[model samples]
Target chain A: MEILSSFIKNPRKTTYGGEDNDEKIIFLLRKSVIVNINWVTVAFILLLLPLFVSPPLSKLTYMGMRVINPGFILALNLFWYIFTIGFIFQNFLAWYFDVLMVTNKKVIDIDQSCTDVSETTLSNVQDVSSKVKGTWGVVLDIGDIFIQTSAEQREFEFLDVSNPSKVRDEIADLVAKIKKRNGS
Target chain B: MVPNLPIRQLVIAGKIIVILIMVLYAVFAFILTKRVKLMNANLTTPQSKLFERIARIHMVLSIFVIILATINL
Candidate 1:
Protein backbone atom coordinates (compact mmCIF):
# COMPACT_ATOMS: atom_id res chain seq x y z
CA MET A 1 0.00 0.00 0.00
CA GLU A 2 2.86 2.36 0.76
CA ILE A 3 4.36 1.64 -2.63
CA LEU A 4 1.04 2.30 -4.31
CA SER A 5 0.41 5.66 -2.64
CA SER A 6 3.99 6.82 -2.23
CA PHE A 7 4.36 10.52 -2.92
CA ILE A 8 3.79 11.54 -6.51
CA LYS A 9 5.32 14.66 -7.98
CA ASN A 10 2.39 15.30 -10.26
CA PRO A 11 -0.55 13.03 -9.55
CA ARG A 12 -3.59 12.81 -11.76
CA LYS A 13 -7.31 12.82 -10.99
CA THR A 14 -7.01 13.78 -7.34
CA THR A 15 -10.07 15.34 -5.70
CA TYR A 16 -8.45 15.99 -2.35
CA GLY A 17 -9.11 19.73 -2.31
CA GLY A 18 -12.67 19.30 -3.52
CA GLU A 19 -14.55 18.59 -6.76
CA ASP A 20 -14.13 22.11 -7.99
CA ASN A 21 -13.87 22.39 -11.73
CA ASP A 22 -10.72 23.54 -13.58
CA GLU A 23 -8.30 22.70 -10.78
CA LYS A 24 -5.47 20.30 -11.60
CA ILE A 25 -3.04 19.01 -9.01
CA ILE A 26 0.57 19.92 -9.73
CA PHE A 27 2.32 18.39 -6.74
CA LEU A 28 1.41 16.14 -3.82
CA LEU A 29 3.73 15.90 -0.83
CA ARG A 30 3.82 14.33 2.60
CA LYS A 31 5.74 15.54 5.63
CA SER A 32 9.52 15.44 5.82
CA VAL A 33 11.45 12.18 5.80
CA ILE A 34 12.43 12.84 9.41
CA VAL A 35 8.85 12.59 10.64
CA ASN A 36 8.39 9.17 9.07
CA ILE A 37 11.74 8.03 10.42
CA ASN A 38 10.59 8.96 13.90
CA TRP A 39 7.47 6.87 13.50
CA VAL A 40 9.55 3.92 12.31
CA THR A 41 11.89 4.25 15.25
CA VAL A 42 9.07 4.25 17.76
CA ALA A 43 7.42 1.26 16.12
CA PHE A 44 10.67 -0.67 16.08
CA ILE A 45 11.13 -0.01 19.77
CA LEU A 46 7.61 -1.15 20.55
CA LEU A 47 8.09 -4.31 18.50
CA LEU A 48 11.26 -5.22 20.37
CA LEU A 49 10.03 -4.44 23.88
CA PRO A 50 8.04 -7.67 24.25
CA LEU A 51 11.07 -9.77 23.30
CA PHE A 52 13.11 -8.08 26.01
CA VAL A 53 10.44 -8.19 28.73
CA SER A 54 8.68 -11.50 28.10
CA PRO A 55 11.58 -13.67 29.22
CA PRO A 56 12.06 -11.99 32.63
CA LEU A 57 8.30 -11.83 33.15
CA SER A 58 7.86 -15.51 32.39
CA LYS A 59 10.83 -16.45 34.54
CA LEU A 60 9.43 -14.48 37.46
CA THR A 61 6.06 -16.20 37.01
CA TYR A 62 7.77 -19.60 36.92
CA MET A 63 9.65 -18.84 40.18
CA GLY A 64 6.27 -18.19 41.89
CA MET A 65 7.33 -14.66 42.68
CA ARG A 66 4.43 -13.31 40.63
CA VAL A 67 0.82 -14.04 41.49
CA ILE A 68 -0.51 -13.75 37.92
CA ASN A 69 -1.93 -16.91 36.38
CA PRO A 70 0.01 -18.20 33.37
CA GLY A 71 -3.09 -18.11 31.20
CA PHE A 72 -3.85 -14.56 32.21
CA ILE A 73 -0.27 -13.57 31.49
CA LEU A 74 -0.47 -15.14 28.04
CA ALA A 75 -3.68 -13.29 27.27
CA LEU A 76 -2.15 -10.04 28.44
CA ASN A 77 0.85 -10.53 26.17
CA LEU A 78 -1.43 -11.14 23.23
CA PHE A 79 -3.37 -8.00 24.08
CA TRP A 80 -0.15 -6.01 24.21
CA TYR A 81 0.88 -7.22 20.79
CA ILE A 82 -2.49 -6.25 19.33
CA PHE A 83 -2.34 -2.86 20.95
CA THR A 84 1.16 -2.25 19.65
CA ILE A 85 0.27 -3.11 16.08
CA GLY A 86 -2.85 -0.96 16.26
CA PHE A 87 -0.91 1.96 17.65
CA ILE A 88 1.65 1.74 14.87
CA PHE A 89 -1.04 1.67 12.23
CA GLN A 90 -2.81 4.65 13.77
CA ASN A 91 0.38 6.67 13.52
CA PHE A 92 0.80 5.70 9.91
CA LEU A 93 -2.72 6.80 9.14
CA ALA A 94 -2.07 10.20 10.65
CA TRP A 95 1.16 10.65 8.73
CA TYR A 96 -0.23 9.44 5.44
CA PHE A 97 -3.28 11.68 5.46
CA ASP A 98 -1.52 14.86 6.50
CA VAL A 99 -0.62 16.43 3.15
CA LEU A 100 0.55 19.55 1.36
CA MET A 101 -0.93 19.92 -2.09
CA VAL A 102 -0.20 22.42 -4.84
CA THR A 103 -2.66 22.94 -7.63
CA ASN A 104 -2.86 25.41 -10.47
CA LYS A 105 -5.26 27.67 -8.63
CA LYS A 106 -4.47 27.14 -4.96
CA VAL A 107 -2.07 25.65 -2.47
CA ILE A 108 -3.74 23.52 0.19
CA ASP A 109 -2.17 22.51 3.45
CA ILE A 110 -3.85 19.77 5.42
CA ASP A 111 -2.90 18.68 8.90
CA GLN A 112 -4.92 15.76 10.19
CA SER A 113 -4.63 13.91 13.48
CA CYS A 114 -6.83 11.33 15.18
CA THR A 115 -9.37 13.78 16.57
CA ASP A 116 -8.82 16.99 14.61
CA VAL A 117 -8.38 18.41 11.14
CA SER A 118 -6.88 21.79 10.24
CA GLU A 119 -6.75 22.87 6.61
CA THR A 120 -5.74 26.07 4.89
CA THR A 121 -5.90 27.18 1.26
CA LEU A 122 -4.18 30.04 -0.46
CA SER A 123 -5.32 31.16 -3.92
CA ASN A 124 -3.74 34.56 -4.23
CA VAL A 125 -0.13 33.66 -3.70
CA GLN A 126 2.23 36.65 -4.14
CA ASP A 127 5.58 35.06 -3.30
CA VAL A 128 7.03 31.67 -2.40
CA SER A 129 10.15 30.54 -0.55
CA SER A 130 11.57 27.26 0.80
CA LYS A 131 14.26 26.74 3.38
CA VAL A 132 16.35 23.67 4.18
CA LYS A 133 18.12 24.40 7.43
CA GLY A 134 19.72 22.18 10.10
CA THR A 135 22.06 19.27 9.48
CA TRP A 136 19.30 16.68 9.14
CA GLY A 137 17.18 18.75 6.76
CA VAL A 138 20.04 19.67 4.45
CA VAL A 139 21.42 16.14 4.43
CA LEU A 140 18.01 14.58 3.83
CA ASP A 141 16.62 17.18 1.35
CA ILE A 142 13.80 18.13 3.68
CA GLY A 143 12.47 21.45 4.98
CA ASP A 144 9.54 23.85 4.90
CA ILE A 145 7.80 25.72 2.04
CA PHE A 146 6.31 29.12 2.73
CA ILE A 147 3.66 30.73 0.55
CA GLN A 148 2.82 34.39 1.03
CA THR A 149 -0.48 35.33 -0.48
CA SER A 150 -3.05 38.14 -0.44
CA ALA A 151 -5.31 36.25 1.93
CA GLU A 152 -6.09 37.81 5.31
CA GLN A 153 -4.91 34.68 7.11
CA ARG A 154 -1.32 33.81 7.86
CA GLU A 155 1.09 32.68 5.16
CA PHE A 156 0.48 29.06 4.13
CA GLU A 157 3.36 26.94 5.31
CA PHE A 158 4.13 23.42 4.13
CA LEU A 159 5.97 22.40 7.27
CA ASP A 160 8.64 19.73 7.33
CA VAL A 161 8.33 18.45 3.79
CA SER A 162 10.98 16.92 1.55
CA ASN A 163 12.54 18.63 -1.49
CA PRO A 164 11.57 22.14 -0.47
CA SER A 165 13.56 23.74 -3.30
CA LYS A 166 11.79 21.77 -5.96
CA VAL A 167 8.43 22.46 -4.30
CA ARG A 168 9.17 26.16 -4.22
CA ASP A 169 10.16 26.22 -7.87
CA GLU A 170 7.00 24.37 -8.86
CA ILE A 171 4.80 26.75 -6.92
CA ALA A 172 6.72 29.72 -8.35
CA ASP A 173 6.17 28.42 -11.84
CA LEU A 174 2.46 27.97 -11.12
CA VAL A 175 2.23 31.46 -9.68
CA ALA A 176 3.88 32.82 -12.80
CA LYS A 177 1.35 31.08 -14.95
CA ILE A 178 -1.50 32.30 -12.80
CA LYS A 179 -0.19 35.85 -13.12
CA LYS A 180 0.22 35.52 -16.86
CA ARG A 181 -3.30 34.17 -17.21
CA ASN A 182 -4.75 36.92 -15.05
CA GLY A 183 -2.70 39.47 -17.04
CA SER A 184 -1.77 41.16 -13.73
CA MET B 1 -15.87 -29.48 44.84
CA VAL B 2 -17.86 -26.25 44.75
CA PRO B 3 -16.10 -22.91 44.43
CA ASN B 4 -16.63 -20.30 47.17
CA LEU B 5 -19.84 -18.30 46.51
CA PRO B 6 -18.34 -14.82 47.03
CA ILE B 7 -15.35 -15.58 44.77
CA ARG B 8 -17.63 -16.78 42.00
CA GLN B 9 -19.78 -13.72 42.40
CA LEU B 10 -16.76 -11.46 42.26
CA VAL B 11 -15.50 -13.15 39.10
CA ILE B 12 -18.89 -12.73 37.45
CA ALA B 13 -18.97 -9.08 38.37
CA GLY B 14 -15.46 -8.55 37.05
CA LYS B 15 -16.40 -10.16 33.75
CA ILE B 16 -19.48 -7.98 33.49
CA ILE B 17 -17.46 -4.86 34.09
CA VAL B 18 -14.94 -5.90 31.42
CA ILE B 19 -17.74 -6.56 28.96
CA LEU B 20 -19.20 -3.15 29.65
CA ILE B 21 -15.84 -1.51 29.05
CA MET B 22 -15.45 -3.39 25.79
CA VAL B 23 -18.90 -2.27 24.63
CA LEU B 24 -18.05 1.33 25.37
CA TYR B 25 -14.78 1.00 23.46
CA ALA B 26 -16.60 -0.51 20.53
CA VAL B 27 -18.83 2.55 20.48
CA PHE B 28 -15.80 4.78 20.53
CA ALA B 29 -14.30 2.88 17.63
CA PHE B 30 -17.56 3.17 15.75
CA ILE B 31 -17.57 6.92 16.18
CA LEU B 32 -14.00 7.13 14.92
CA THR B 33 -14.91 5.11 11.84
CA LYS B 34 -17.79 7.45 11.14
CA ARG B 35 -15.49 10.46 11.35
CA VAL B 36 -13.06 8.85 8.94
CA LYS B 37 -15.88 8.20 6.53
CA LEU B 38 -16.86 11.83 6.66
CA MET B 39 -13.30 12.94 6.08
CA ASN B 40 -12.96 10.59 3.14
CA ALA B 41 -16.07 11.97 1.52
CA ASN B 42 -14.39 15.36 1.05
CA LEU B 43 -11.04 14.06 -0.22
CA THR B 44 -10.37 11.47 -2.89
CA THR B 45 -6.72 10.70 -2.31
CA PRO B 46 -5.00 7.33 -2.05
CA GLN B 47 -3.95 8.11 1.51
CA SER B 48 -7.51 8.92 2.49
CA LYS B 49 -8.75 5.58 1.21
CA LEU B 50 -5.99 3.75 3.02
CA PHE B 51 -6.77 5.64 6.23
CA GLU B 52 -10.47 4.79 5.96
CA ARG B 53 -9.63 1.13 5.46
CA ILE B 54 -7.35 1.08 8.50
CA ALA B 55 -9.99 2.75 10.65
CA ARG B 56 -12.68 0.27 9.57
CA ILE B 57 -10.42 -2.72 10.15
CA HIS B 58 -9.43 -1.39 13.53
CA MET B 59 -13.07 -0.99 14.51
CA VAL B 60 -14.00 -4.53 13.42
CA LEU B 61 -10.97 -6.15 15.00
CA SER B 62 -11.57 -4.29 18.26
CA ILE B 63 -15.05 -5.77 18.45
CA PHE B 64 -13.71 -9.24 17.75
CA VAL B 65 -11.04 -8.86 20.39
CA ILE B 66 -13.68 -7.81 22.86
CA ILE B 67 -15.78 -10.86 22.05
CA LEU B 68 -12.77 -13.14 22.43
CA ALA B 69 -11.94 -11.62 25.79
CA THR B 70 -15.49 -12.06 26.94
CA ILE B 71 -15.65 -15.72 25.93
CA ASN B 72 -12.13 -17.05 26.51
CA LEU B 73 -10.61 -14.87 29.24
Candidate 2:
Protein backbone atom coordinates (compact mmCIF):
# COMPACT_ATOMS: atom_id res chain seq x y z
CA MET A 1 0.00 0.00 0.00
CA GLU A 2 1.08 3.64 -0.47
CA ILE A 3 0.68 4.27 3.30
CA LEU A 4 3.14 1.49 4.13
CA SER A 5 5.73 2.89 1.71
CA SER A 6 5.41 6.38 3.16
CA PHE A 7 5.65 4.94 6.67
CA ILE A 8 8.90 3.23 5.74
CA LYS A 9 10.20 6.43 4.15
CA ASN A 10 9.39 8.57 7.22
CA PRO A 11 10.36 6.64 10.32
CA ARG A 12 9.81 7.96 13.83
CA LYS A 13 12.60 10.01 15.40
CA THR A 14 14.16 8.60 18.60
CA THR A 15 16.26 10.02 21.42
CA TYR A 16 18.96 7.49 20.60
CA GLY A 17 19.81 9.46 17.44
CA GLY A 18 18.12 10.91 14.37
CA GLU A 19 15.41 9.02 12.51
CA ASP A 20 17.71 7.73 9.80
CA ASN A 21 20.26 6.12 12.14
CA ASP A 22 17.94 5.06 14.99
CA GLU A 23 16.58 1.90 13.37
CA LYS A 24 20.02 0.44 12.69
CA ILE A 25 20.25 -1.27 16.08
CA ILE A 26 18.00 -4.16 17.09
CA PHE A 27 17.04 -3.59 20.74
CA LEU A 28 16.35 -6.36 23.29
CA LEU A 29 14.48 -6.35 26.60
CA ARG A 30 16.91 -6.63 29.55
CA LYS A 31 14.82 -9.10 31.53
CA SER A 32 13.60 -12.59 30.68
CA VAL A 33 9.90 -13.64 30.74
CA ILE A 34 10.63 -15.78 33.81
CA VAL A 35 11.16 -12.63 35.84
CA ASN A 36 7.48 -11.73 35.40
CA ILE A 37 6.45 -15.16 36.59
CA ASN A 38 8.61 -14.74 39.70
CA TRP A 39 7.13 -11.31 40.40
CA VAL A 40 3.60 -12.66 40.05
CA THR A 41 4.33 -15.50 42.46
CA VAL A 42 5.73 -13.12 45.06
CA ALA A 43 2.82 -10.71 44.71
CA PHE A 44 0.29 -13.52 45.09
CA ILE A 45 1.98 -14.85 48.23
CA LEU A 46 2.14 -11.38 49.78
CA LEU A 47 -1.52 -10.63 49.08
CA LEU A 48 -2.87 -14.03 50.10
CA LEU A 49 -2.28 -13.71 53.86
CA PRO A 50 -3.74 -10.21 53.98
CA LEU A 51 -6.80 -11.25 51.98
CA PHE A 52 -7.66 -13.96 54.50
CA VAL A 53 -6.69 -12.04 57.61
CA SER A 54 -8.34 -8.71 56.78
CA PRO A 55 -11.96 -9.90 56.56
CA PRO A 56 -11.99 -11.43 60.05
CA LEU A 57 -10.26 -8.41 61.52
CA SER A 58 -12.69 -6.09 59.80
CA LYS A 59 -15.63 -8.11 61.12
CA LEU A 60 -14.26 -8.03 64.68
CA THR A 61 -13.65 -4.29 64.49
CA TYR A 62 -17.16 -3.77 63.12
CA MET A 63 -18.65 -5.69 66.05
CA GLY A 64 -16.64 -3.57 68.46
CA MET A 65 -17.79 -0.32 66.76
CA ARG A 66 -18.71 1.32 70.09
CA VAL A 67 -15.00 1.32 71.08
CA ILE A 68 -13.64 2.69 67.74
CA ASN A 69 -15.12 3.95 64.46
CA PRO A 70 -15.20 1.30 61.69
CA GLY A 71 -14.77 4.08 59.14
CA PHE A 72 -11.17 4.60 60.39
CA ILE A 73 -10.34 0.91 59.72
CA LEU A 74 -11.92 1.15 56.25
CA ALA A 75 -9.85 4.24 55.49
CA LEU A 76 -6.69 2.39 56.53
CA ASN A 77 -7.51 -0.48 54.16
CA LEU A 78 -8.10 1.99 51.32
CA PHE A 79 -4.67 3.54 51.91
CA TRP A 80 -3.05 0.07 51.96
CA TYR A 81 -4.67 -0.80 48.62
CA ILE A 82 -3.51 2.47 47.06
CA PHE A 83 0.08 1.97 48.26
CA THR A 84 0.25 -1.62 46.95
CA ILE A 85 -1.12 -0.63 43.53
CA GLY A 86 1.40 2.21 43.28
CA PHE A 87 4.27 -0.11 44.21
CA ILE A 88 3.28 -2.65 41.55
CA PHE A 89 3.00 0.03 38.88
CA GLN A 90 6.45 1.40 39.77
CA ASN A 91 8.03 -2.05 39.50
CA PHE A 92 6.37 -2.72 36.14
CA LEU A 93 7.57 0.59 34.67
CA ALA A 94 11.09 0.01 36.02
CA TRP A 95 11.21 -3.40 34.36
CA TYR A 96 9.81 -2.00 31.11
CA PHE A 97 12.40 0.79 30.94
CA ASP A 98 15.55 -1.22 31.68
CA VAL A 99 16.76 -2.30 28.24
CA LEU A 100 20.05 -3.42 26.67
CA MET A 101 20.97 -3.87 23.01
CA VAL A 102 23.93 -4.66 20.79
CA THR A 103 24.12 -2.79 17.52
CA ASN A 104 26.20 -3.97 14.56
CA LYS A 105 28.89 -1.45 15.50
CA LYS A 106 28.09 -0.35 19.08
CA VAL A 107 26.34 -1.04 22.41
CA ILE A 108 23.40 0.97 23.73
CA ASP A 109 22.44 1.39 27.39
CA ILE A 110 18.93 2.53 28.38
CA ASP A 111 17.62 3.09 31.91
CA GLN A 112 14.42 4.49 33.37
CA SER A 113 14.30 5.45 37.01
CA CYS A 114 10.58 6.30 37.04
CA THR A 115 7.84 7.50 34.69
CA ASP A 116 9.30 10.94 33.95
CA VAL A 117 12.77 10.35 32.49
CA SER A 118 15.06 7.95 30.64
CA GLU A 119 18.87 7.97 30.20
CA THR A 120 20.90 6.39 27.41
CA THR A 121 24.55 5.84 26.64
CA LEU A 122 26.07 4.69 23.33
CA SER A 123 29.52 3.10 23.11
CA ASN A 124 31.60 1.54 20.37
CA VAL A 125 31.81 -2.24 20.59
CA GLN A 126 35.59 -2.32 20.24
CA ASP A 127 36.10 -0.33 23.41
CA VAL A 128 33.91 -2.47 25.69
CA SER A 129 35.60 -4.35 28.53
CA SER A 130 33.63 -7.03 30.43
CA LYS A 131 34.16 -7.27 34.18
CA VAL A 132 32.35 -9.66 36.53
CA LYS A 133 32.87 -8.53 40.09
CA GLY A 134 31.87 -10.22 43.37
CA THR A 135 31.20 -13.95 43.89
CA TRP A 136 27.47 -13.60 43.43
CA GLY A 137 27.86 -11.79 40.12
CA VAL A 138 30.16 -14.52 38.78
CA VAL A 139 27.82 -17.30 39.85
CA LEU A 140 24.74 -15.55 38.46
CA ASP A 141 26.44 -14.62 35.16
CA ILE A 142 25.56 -10.95 35.47
CA GLY A 143 28.12 -8.14 35.49
CA ASP A 144 28.99 -4.67 34.24
CA ILE A 145 30.33 -3.69 30.81
CA PHE A 146 32.94 -0.91 31.01
CA ILE A 147 33.27 0.81 27.63
CA GLN A 148 36.16 3.22 27.05
CA THR A 149 35.62 5.07 23.75
CA SER A 150 38.23 7.17 21.97
CA ALA A 151 35.58 9.66 20.89
CA GLU A 152 34.43 10.22 24.47
CA GLN A 153 37.05 11.14 27.07
CA ARG A 154 35.43 9.18 29.92
CA GLU A 155 34.43 5.52 30.09
CA PHE A 156 30.73 4.67 30.00
CA GLU A 157 29.64 1.74 32.14
CA PHE A 158 26.60 -0.47 31.50
CA LEU A 159 25.90 -1.96 34.89
CA ASP A 160 24.37 -5.36 35.74
CA VAL A 161 23.62 -6.55 32.21
CA SER A 162 22.73 -10.24 32.00
CA ASN A 163 25.08 -12.77 30.45
CA PRO A 164 27.89 -10.24 30.03
CA SER A 165 30.33 -12.87 28.84
CA LYS A 166 28.18 -13.73 25.82
CA VAL A 167 27.69 -10.03 25.06
CA ARG A 168 31.43 -9.44 25.26
CA ASP A 169 32.14 -12.32 22.88
CA GLU A 170 29.54 -11.09 20.39
CA ILE A 171 30.99 -7.57 20.48
CA ALA A 172 34.54 -8.88 20.06
CA ASP A 173 33.47 -10.85 16.96
CA LEU A 174 31.69 -7.82 15.48
CA VAL A 175 34.69 -5.57 16.10
CA ALA A 176 36.96 -8.10 14.36
CA LYS A 177 34.69 -8.09 11.33
CA ILE A 178 34.57 -4.28 11.20
CA LYS A 179 38.34 -4.10 11.50
CA LYS A 180 38.79 -6.69 8.76
CA ARG A 181 36.41 -4.78 6.48
CA ASN A 182 38.29 -1.52 7.04
CA GLY A 183 41.68 -3.26 6.59
CA SER A 184 42.92 -1.65 9.81
CA MET B 1 1.56 4.51 81.27
CA VAL B 2 4.13 6.33 79.11
CA PRO B 3 1.25 8.50 77.83
CA ASN B 4 2.00 9.75 74.26
CA LEU B 5 5.79 9.39 74.74
CA PRO B 6 6.15 6.42 72.37
CA ILE B 7 4.37 8.18 69.50
CA ARG B 8 6.35 11.40 70.07
CA GLN B 9 9.67 9.52 70.11
CA LEU B 10 8.70 7.56 66.97
CA VAL B 11 7.79 10.77 65.08
CA ILE B 12 11.12 12.36 66.01
CA ALA B 13 13.09 9.29 64.91
CA GLY B 14 11.16 9.13 61.63
CA LYS B 15 11.88 12.81 60.98
CA ILE B 16 15.61 12.27 61.50
CA ILE B 17 15.68 9.25 59.18
CA VAL B 18 13.75 11.09 56.47
CA ILE B 19 16.12 14.06 56.64
CA LEU B 20 19.17 11.79 56.33
CA ILE B 21 17.71 9.96 53.31
CA MET B 22 16.86 13.26 51.61
CA VAL B 23 20.42 14.54 52.12
CA LEU B 24 21.86 11.36 50.57
CA TYR B 25 19.53 11.54 47.56
CA ALA B 26 20.43 15.21 47.06
CA VAL B 27 24.13 14.36 47.02
CA PHE B 28 23.54 11.57 44.46
CA ALA B 29 21.50 13.88 42.21
CA PHE B 30 24.21 16.54 42.40
CA ILE B 31 26.95 14.11 41.33
CA LEU B 32 24.89 12.79 38.40
CA THR B 33 24.03 16.31 37.22
CA LYS B 34 27.68 17.36 37.37
CA ARG B 35 28.69 14.41 35.18
CA VAL B 36 25.94 15.19 32.65
CA LYS B 37 27.01 18.84 32.56
CA LEU B 38 30.62 17.84 31.84
CA MET B 39 29.51 15.59 28.99
CA ASN B 40 27.29 18.31 27.56
CA ALA B 41 30.15 20.82 27.64
CA ASN B 42 32.26 18.49 25.49
CA LEU B 43 29.38 17.55 23.15
CA THR B 44 28.11 21.13 22.83
CA THR B 45 24.49 20.19 23.41
CA PRO B 46 21.79 21.73 25.62
CA GLN B 47 19.95 18.43 26.16
CA SER B 48 22.03 17.60 29.26
CA LYS B 49 20.58 20.62 31.07
CA LEU B 50 17.11 19.20 30.58
CA PHE B 51 18.23 15.89 32.07
CA GLU B 52 19.74 17.70 35.04
CA ARG B 53 16.45 19.48 35.72
CA ILE B 54 14.55 16.22 35.52
CA ALA B 55 16.94 14.60 37.99
CA ARG B 56 16.56 17.55 40.36
CA ILE B 57 12.76 17.20 40.24
CA HIS B 58 13.04 13.50 40.97
CA MET B 59 15.17 14.19 44.01
CA VAL B 60 12.72 16.83 45.23
CA LEU B 61 9.73 14.51 44.89
CA SER B 62 11.57 11.68 46.62
CA ILE B 63 12.33 13.99 49.52
CA PHE B 64 8.71 15.13 49.64
CA VAL B 65 7.49 11.54 49.84
CA ILE B 66 9.85 10.71 52.67
CA ILE B 67 8.73 13.77 54.61
CA LEU B 68 5.06 12.94 54.13
CA ALA B 69 5.64 9.34 55.19
CA THR B 70 7.48 10.47 58.29
CA ILE B 71 4.63 12.78 59.30
CA ASN B 72 2.09 9.99 58.84
CA LEU B 73 4.24 7.55 60.80
Per-residue lDDT over B3-67 for candidate 1, one digit per residue giving the tens place of the 0 to 100 score: 33454455557656765766776676777778777666655665567777777887787677676
Which digits, one per residue and each the tens of the lDDT, describe model 1 over residues A125-151? Answer: 778999988998888888888888777
lDDT of each: 0.67, 0.48
TM-score of each: 0.77, 0.48
If you score just chain A, what TM-score does every candidate get? 0.81, 0.60
Off by over 4 Å in 1: A1-7, A55-71, A114-123, B1-28, B47-49
| Predicted structure 1: lDDT | 0.67
* Candidate 1 interface RMSD (Å): 4.4
Candidate 2, lDDT over the whole model: 0.48
Candidate 1 — which pairs collide? none
DockQ of 2: 0.05
Model 1, residue B57: what's the lDDT? 80
List the lowest-lDDT window of 10 residues for candidate 2 chain A.
Answer: A2-11
In model 1 chain A, where is the ten-residue run with the lowest total lDDT? A61-70
